[model samples]
Target chain A: MRVHELETPAVLIDLDVMERNLARMAEYCRRHGLALRPHTKTHKIPELAHRQMASGASGITVAKLGEAEVMIQAGLTDVLIAYPIVGREKAARLAALAERASLTVALDSEEAVRDISRSAQERGVRLGLLVELDIGFRRCGVQRPDEAVALARLIHDLPNVDFRGVMFYPGHFMAPEPERRQLLEDANTRLRRFYDAFERAGLSIGVVSGGSTPTAFISHEFLGVTEIRPGMYIFNDRTMVGLGVARPEDCALSILVTVVSTSVSGRAIVDGGSKTFSTDRYRAGDGRGFGLVCEDPEAEVEALSEEHGHLDISRSSRRYRVGERLRIIPNHVCTVMNLHDEVYGIRGDQVEAVWRVAARGRVR
Target chain B: MRVHELETPAVLIDLDVMERNLARMAEYCRRHGLALRPHTKTHKIPELAHRQMASGASGITVAKLGEAEVMIQAGLTDVLIAYPIVGREKAARLAALAERASLTVALDSEEAVRDISRSAQERGVRLGLLVELDIGFRRCGVQRPDEAVALARLIHDLPNVDFRGVMFYPGHFMAPEPERRQLLEDANTRLRRFYDAFERAGLSIGVVSGGSTPTAFISHEFLGVTEIRPGMYIFNDRTMVGLGVARPEDCALSILVTVVSTSVSGRAIVDGGSKTFSTDRYRAGDGRGFGLVCEDPEAEVEALSEEHGHLDISRSSRRYRVGERLRIIPNHVCTVMNLHDEVYGIRGDQVEAVWRVAARGRVR
Candidate 1:
């Protein structure tokens, strides 16, 4: 079947573009002597993670135990749960997963470490632990270098736990050109401080995982970083485009939507909305609209209800009639992918595959 | 199983609270002599929709044909797809669905009307259509009253199409009391003009559907509105609380999340984030956070990444530790419900049932 023949509000993945993106990222990481463990939170597909592994990814990184379970069940032997795992049930589940695969977890708090350690010891399984450092992204990880060393020391003492290394997410480094470069420099300085602290503590940091799509290509600049866990690089989005990291042509995924209503003047409504494309705005740009209209670049999706994409066609010279199909590259691809149950993989106009987003909505 | 024993980042629906919400709305519509066609987009479960039907609902309202199909398959005889049905394939699907159930589609454009009319005629199915009017919310409706009459006339002329009066979404009338009163007055004036235009056109307007959660109770204030379609009243969120339409105690759905990280000084991280709770801010409030922390009402979900809910617990006098469970009422319940696959129906602390969000992600 053709891509256009598919249902409206369908997610389409350009196979050629996606393959190129994966190959490019894999090659970049290989050249930099960095292990590529592309985050599976973006696509949430086990097959795509397998493809990433086939493209020379060392392992796969996931944000939740549910996602890791999906990947492990799909024959993946090595996996990393990048988020902190707390609670007795989750820790027990993590230990159970560790029994099946070579599992690693990155966490900040000593409480989480102890929780997981107790579960792993009870299950008689060894799990790799990466002390998460709060280099800049203030969401997770420890603040000071001493805190990181303390966590590492605690992990080293914990039974059934291996102190692998440190991991930090430079999410704040997604600024544009010159500003991004400066942010990278500051991030590297912070990395050096953590490395110096680790060395002074007589700790051998085996793996230093840190990278986002904005800083993926410059992973070498981090000096001591060993692995890159960029998720969005596999399927580029408008945020990556706005950050000058990926071109519009590099965006592999697009929502095929049909114009449902053009009754309101200067605005047309599409079948896709927040429930389809999500409410994630283009933060890397002017922070205005929800997506980039591929049909008419000037047409802006100004607002969205649950199932109505309010397209501002005032700027576009082209006229949109109801039932007309249009493709939109959403601002954030990760959230958009998570919203759907399945996605179509297309080669040009032909639908080659329909892959169920097996790991989507696995927030547990 | 207990609700607490369930996994973190799980969607929990207080069944008692939901039943009370359903009963209240039913009684309100019964007293007001309005047809209560509650929108099922909030819960998206076939059973919940059936429960709404059991609660004296005239019919059920859905935003997409996929949702209509789900409801119809679940033995609903009357379902109103309160959204535009565009494209040949979708129209064919709509026609096919009409063969099994009484389906009414609401659209603003003549192109959509003609498109669906062609399919319905070919399939020997007479489909009902409501000419959507822009009462105040400028999303997907005709601006002028004359345009609505014109669309009605066109629908009347079209083969296999029944003109079922008019419909409008009063989404803009969700302000606080004083401002909301003014907006409602403006909306009523606009609705009156549409009614006058329909009367002058010699149109027997059978149905006048209008209402959102905010404007649902005041639906009788609109002179010609005969049906109310409020979705969020089933699972009230922080938005409804902020709008003073529903209190925090009235919210039926709350996400069960685990506090994962507390390393950051005034902030804590929960397992639920934009992918779980969504990026929709609390528009009815000060619009600072993504959700209301039910544990400490003063604590706010300041920001969200894909898998991390950043909680600002500075104002709360409580200190959060790792493994602590928190329940969050999201800003928008509809979008939050769309992100999850299933919801646990609980009675107090006991899990009574597990419901699959059957109609979720059916944007087509």
Candidate 2:
């Protein structure tokens, strides 16, 4: 649908720009000699995964087994689940998925390793599992080097299981820090220590994966990493701009919304609300609220209701009268795209294609 | 699925409890001699709408044309779209829905009225339009009674359109307060003035509708209003408990979540993240966070990541271990249910039935 003629609060993806972004990231990985596994959790659409593969991605990375299942059904064979799997039902699901495709799972704890091993033995399938190590963020993963070594030893000793390499997420390194030599050297030291422990355990690790979007930009010298998974590079959002990674023109996906009314301090209320933008709050240091106004970069959407997005478009000299359509670049692209069923892929204001978010509600 | 066997972070709706809640609202409306037009936007499944009709609801209300289309396709005959129709696509869609169903639409401006009137006239159907007056919340609707009258006059002057009545929403009054009487009275004053203006404009106003969950629990006497549309009472949430409108036990919908990890203090990470419990946040003076910690009313969920829900889960001497499940009353019940493609309706721990959120992704 045309932007001016269609309804407000619809998700829009620029197809030409997105193809360029996919190619740029793929070429970056090729030039740096890093295996590219774009996270399907970001776009969660099979077509986008196919596009990433066509652009030279080695495989797909997912956050959940259900997401991996969708990719497998869509002909994406090599898949990596970046989440630790526990529970009898979940392990069975993982084992079943491993039977169809090359599945590698993450294990962060002793309990997880034992559980996964037991499930793999019961299913009579050799499960490929990675021991997760936390470099920072303090969310998941083993912090101690000895613990990582022990996890790898346990998984290797168990029946019907193969111990893959370690996985560490250095999310804290993505803050656009002033690249001190100490920070770089310290990250290398930790990685070296972990790999040394794995070597001492007499285990041959298959893949040593680490780095996110912001971290992968400087990952060429991260020393001991084999693969990099950067999902949001294909659809840079306001958060990327806030973190100083990408520019506004680099944002590939934007919400096509209309100005429903202009009232209350010239505030134009759009039809998008928390349901569309999500309730994610980001501290960009400037204290701008909700999401970044895309059509007008300086404009701010200070508040959101369930069905109403409020924007402070009062000060712009541009005339945005009622029924005017505007595009919004959300702060967090992954979460916002996850909230929609399908997004229109526009090529210079023409609706070229519609991509169904294949794994939109695969939260299991 | 059985409550104990089903995966954590899944939504569970007890059919028996939901029926009781639905009966309670219907009985209250019957006693008050008021028409109950339950808004189906809460649970977009048409089966629930059919059950509501079987229990004596005058009609069901929808938030968007996409949702209305889904319900109508499921054989629902009458629907009231409680939001304005502003675009060509939406107006045309609304007119198409009018052919087979008795549709009542809310309009607060002449532009929307003329848009709907033009489409409905072309389709040879008279569209029923309600003049939405602002009572509070400052979102949509005409600001004053005279503006509502002017809008009604314009709607009546247009061909193939009927002025249904004045619709005013007191959403800000949904917060619990001792001054609830003043809030309701203030809302009534504006609505009564609008009703008089409609009469002075020689309009045949049919339905005066207004009510949210908080206002539904109290006296819903809006001067000359004939109907009240409250959707969340069927599945109460923590927002209801926080507002002192409903007790925790009344929350029939909950996210059955498993404690995935334990780090320090009484903190535990649940499998439910913003994807499941949603990211809606509202606090009372006591400073309640995302949700009220079940079994420990004093505790709250302090933080949330993409796939992790952080909870300060204990206020007593009992320690919370990993693998334990906690039932989470979400901040907003409506949005939480919408996130899921389907919900399990159970009784105690037994699996009874599954309901498809037929219009979950119908956010046009």
Best by lDDT: 1
Q: Once superposed on the true structure, which residue ranges of model 1 sit more than 4 Å away at CA?
A: none
In order, the Cα lDDT scores of the candidates are 0.90, 0.79
Q: How many residue pairs clash in each candidate?
A: 0, 0
Which TM-score values does chain B get in all models? 0.98, 0.95
Any runs in candidate 2 off by more than 4 Å, and if so which? A1-8, A173-193, A199-204, A221-223, A263-265, B179-182, B219-221, B263-267, B285-288, B293-299, B313-322
Tens digits of lDDT, candidate 2, B175-257: 55877778777777766677777678677778888877788856456687688899898898877887787877888888888
Candidate 1 local lDDT, residue A161: 95
Q: What local lDDT does model 1 show for residue B109?
A: 86
Writing each residue's lDDT as its tens digit, candidate 1 over B1-364 gives 9987888889999988999999999999999999999899988999988899999999899989889889999999999988988778889999999999999999888888988999999999999999888877888889898888899999989899999888889888777889988887888788888888888999999998988889889889987889999999998998899989998889999999988999989999999999899898688757778888887977978889999999988888998988889898899999988998888999999999999999989888
TM-score for the A-chain in each candidate structure: 0.98, 0.95
Per-residue lDDT value at B236 in model 2: 85
